[model samples]
Target: MISAISGSVAQSFRPPAISLAARGTESVQPKGSDSGKSSRLGALTEEQKKQVEQLKKTDREVRAHEQAHKNAGGQFTGSASFGYTVGPDGRRYAVSGEVPIDVAPVEGDPAATVSKMTIVASAALAPAKPSGQDRKVAALATSIRTEAQAELAAKSRDKLSGKDESDSKSSALSAQAAYTTGSSPEKGSQIAGSLLDLFS
Candidate 1:
């Protein structure tokens, strides 16, 4: 029997504050000052220059992080969105970003769901340095995949032993419960070993 699963997952990233000085400078910039003229009239203070460089670095990192998710997720992911903060240089820089990923299981097909979850987990960890949310999504996908594998193992066991429909479903439910709660280490291990054998 196919387990019911739903919902989507997105990984969002927001770096920590660059520095205390940078934060203070952000609040003091004139709202409507001409950036070009100001740069031409007087060179930026060393602190302002450091803040601009930090913002530039953050912008590059945010773009790369989202792009990694998009590239690995393929059709399962949507376009990335960014949250911007204006730098001391009066240019907008991406301070945070998110990439939405489809995490819903394929209806009535545990094998297909397993495959999809594997891809989803891979996408979540595709970046060089995954954020906390990215790790959570990966862990969720892994749990879903394990459940699907348990279901598949149950079906295979029933077919081999010639169990009737009611008995088959009971076995499947038991297997799913064992995997979910990890109540019986031996039983869980047997199911997991069976899954490996079946897939391998």
Candidate 2:
């Protein structure tokens, strides 16, 4: 995707100054037409709306992610994208990609993945903090975390099977010993030979 500064994006493509009315209502869809759509709107499709909502979430993430830079007393050139749309409340909300690679913590170990998930989940689930943007940001994080958990789980299952298979081999050996009850020397020799064959 062509990456450009958010400000440059806004200035470069000026959607006709929508009426103050649309700006107030933020409805990209046409009103009173009963069509539930717009011809001129660069308005998002259902999927695009979902994408934009996901992107808009980066705004909240920007707030959270940039804090690290601020604490370190560094200049934050944190970036975001634009999904051009007028909101229902008649405001211009710039949409961008949510959960930029740099914004969300990387998923490595399973426990670490869970930790990242918990932190983002806590921010989303908190009752006292009343920011829609925060909720979206957390939602994006939760999405990534869920994916990480699934990856970790699949890896664990594959690893788990190796150990389980070893246990099965041991059980087979025990079964062989138990069945070799006839203790005559010839029988013992045959049993030992059979056990060796099984191992081989």
Please provide the root mean square deviation of candidate 1 (C-alpha atoms, Å).
16.6
Best by TM-score: 1
Tell me the TM-score of model 1: 0.64
What lDDT tens digits, residue by residue, belong to model 2 across residues 1-200? 11112222321222234232211214354356634444322555677666556645743553443343223212212332334445442335443221222224453576676665566555343434324544554565577678788888899999999889999999888767667864355567899999999999
Q: After superposition, how far is residue 107 of candidate 1 from its true place, in Å?
A: 1.0
lDDT per model vs. reference = 0.74, 0.47
TM-score (all chains, Cα) for each model:
0.64, 0.36
- Residues 82-172, candidate 1: write the lDDT tens digits: 6678766666677677778887888889999899999989998998898888887788889989999999999899887776777889988
Tell me how far the alpha carbon of residue 24 in candidate 2 is from the true structure, in angstroms, after superposition. Answer: 30
- Give lDDT for model 2: 0.47
